[model samples]
Target: MSTSFLLFFALAGSVVAQNFWFSFGDSYTQTGFLDNEALPSVANPFGNPPFPGFTATGGPNWIDFDTTTHNNSLVFTYNYAFGGATIDANLVAPFEPTVLSVTDQVNQFLQTVASKPASTPWTSENSLFSIWIGINDLGNSYFLSDNRTSFDTTLLDAEFALVQQLVSTHSSLFDVGARNFLFLNVPPTDRSPLMLAEPASAQAMLKANILDFNSQLVEFAENFKASNAGVTTLIWDSNTAFNTILDDPTAFGFIDAVSFGTGPGFFWINTLHTTSPANVFWAEGVADVLEGTIF
Candidate 1:
């Protein structure tokens, strides 16, 4: 976290309602758009049934918290995340061909702007756009021979380019009046249940890669902020948040964060996903960050 973020957190509550929230990323941030056939609009902003959408975190993920509990009546939610998504088509393909890649998700939003009925009331000033991706990118990249430099040039560099693509294309988003942006760095994947099962050396290597990816992401966020005046951008320290609880689950209110057993209420429900309790904590942190930056 930066001193700037700390300052933002201290004064975020005053931000006026965003009214609309847009999310894009992989399964961790995904809310099963394909499963619900959801669209971004006022009447049915979530989907047909208006459920939380299927999430690996067991139940209502971060977006759920943002839209349901934290948001006011004026706010609406539209999640465009899919399981197994990557920043671009180069990393991992979606689980199914129809699942939207991060790029695809953003393009879909652009299409919505271009085609929505004139009466539709989405304005960039009243919306918040968030992206939580890059897990699969690093997860797939780390074990490919353990060479750090190779990982940076091939995987990290490519990921940075994708970030640049999203931010620099502000014209499309900014043209439509979207000003608030939130970028989540990759979490501590080495602490996840599956990574815990790996050997210590393997964990160390993967951890190093995650740190490098996050460092580069921070750089991108800073650059985007400096160049794009009037756009509010905040990079949530997901790595720190995840590692804090992993270090002391009880401190964060988890009954047993270390125990990744079968059943609900554990830190992780499977080799890769966590339960809603953890997601709720993350969502809270994100809400703070949003308030800090936009309000």
Candidate 2:
């Protein structure tokens, strides 16, 4: 091609490369799974890989979109998971009155969103948002704080309220007019190293609460669908799969002790992560769900 023609094509290509994928949650959805350039390897041991550090290759993460599909597409996914983040971490202005007593991460998300998110670049047509938060709301309340029953009672209401708030308030970005989205409800945070280290006696309660939380999530998705016909959004149940991993580490080629670790014959070596192969497994499932449910 002529130089002028090439230059014009290059400029046009850059314009089309602005599509985005936004992620909200903890390590389950962040660059934690992939080798994003910005992650801290020292604090996050599994950020790197072959399985113990950050990398340019996109670590083993579910939110890591298809590079081929996203190539020249400018697909930017945001990792809104704050380290040690939780639900209701900050319930005030720095944090908005969130649905769940979740955390600063959620508050920060609300903060970053424009009062008028319906603005230009934030248009829904050019973006896809994947939200996988909420487990921390219940998990932290139950495990870290030692108040399972009471938290569970209050949390479901909070989870429902949060979902409703997100769906109703963020209609512009989520519904996207004719465009739609995928909402990932709570992945199993209880399976993380923080909770897995608990005594076996605590395991049953931990697993049960996760199920209860996931049930509420499913209910919210279904309820939203029934109530709003115009919303094209759908739910991707990462919660089920993540729970599977936690319940039986060996299923996903993991051997967990205090955390997701590597030893003897296991592939997962980090406290809260799996190897590239495992990460790929989860990502494939997410891709399939998107393909089957959304677009």
Candidate 3:
């Protein structure tokens, strides 16, 4: 066999060997999940063309890249993320009422577990559950107020609450025999185009809020691990990855590193999202960090 074929087999083997991958979060992690419900062809399981969802990349998002191209083909990918979802809807709700909140997504997973088909089964050893949220939660809060002290306090409490919910959700997932997990924290939203347009003082406050949220997230992960047994978890710091790219875009192979647009060289697709090129970079960073942990 040729070298390319051998390499393909190696990568495919890694993916097929894993039990299942279930992703839960907002648009950043969404890939037309609900659209899959109506798709006839299982080949493009994510419902790409007619149902691109709200992927900022203008194409397959990271989850799509991992389950489809990255893995060659995934055994199964149950992505339950909505474009504007939040951990708690009361804290932040997507534009559509049908969008599943983080809690709702977890509940849906539980329902999926209960009604799983015989052809596709899940096991604790091979299954992976990942979550990447909190941007909207912070975004809504930031937009609601400009007071640094109040926003900071409220955001921190919300982060703590989210972690607590995760602990409970993981316990339930564990009961159903899901062990491996990956958690991606919030990135630097303050640096995004929309936020960048804000006054310097507001921008600085937003950055500080993100830092507080991420710090609390780390602590929550530690607590969750301590409380649970035989569960392997990896928290990918997306914040650091984003910052690194912003610090030196050329190093990561970008042309218009400073500009924000949909064209070549630009990073930010809008004030709220990154371009496809930047998404690829972000996806690679995530894949690299998950190297030894998941595979």
As for candidate 3, its clashing pairs are: 19-126, 194-271, 256-265
Of candidate 1, the 10-residue stretch with the lowest lDDT total is 1-10
Please identify model 3 stretches exceeding 4 Å from their true place.
1-18, 35-42, 45-54, 71-75, 95-98, 114-116, 143-174, 256-258
Clashing pairs in 1: 12-291, 15-295, 124-177, 124-178
TM-scores for all candidates?
0.80, 0.62, 0.80
- Tens-place lDDT digits, model 2, residues 37-123: 332122222222223223222344444434223123334444554333344454211122432223444444455542325422455
Cα lDDT of candidate 1 equals 0.68
Clashes of 1: 4
- Please write out the lDDT profile of model 1 over residues 1-295, one tens digit for every residue: 1122223223657553335667788899876654225454444456534557778877878877766565443455677787887777656554567667787887776666422335345665666778898787778767776565555555545554544544454454344445677889889888887887889988888899888878877776677667777767788898998888888887766766556654655878778887888888887788778664432
The clash count for each model shown is 4, 21, 3
Candidates ranked, most accurate by TM-score first: 1, 3, 2
Highest lDDT, which number? 1
Q: What's model 1's TM-score?
A: 0.80
* TM-score top scorer: 1
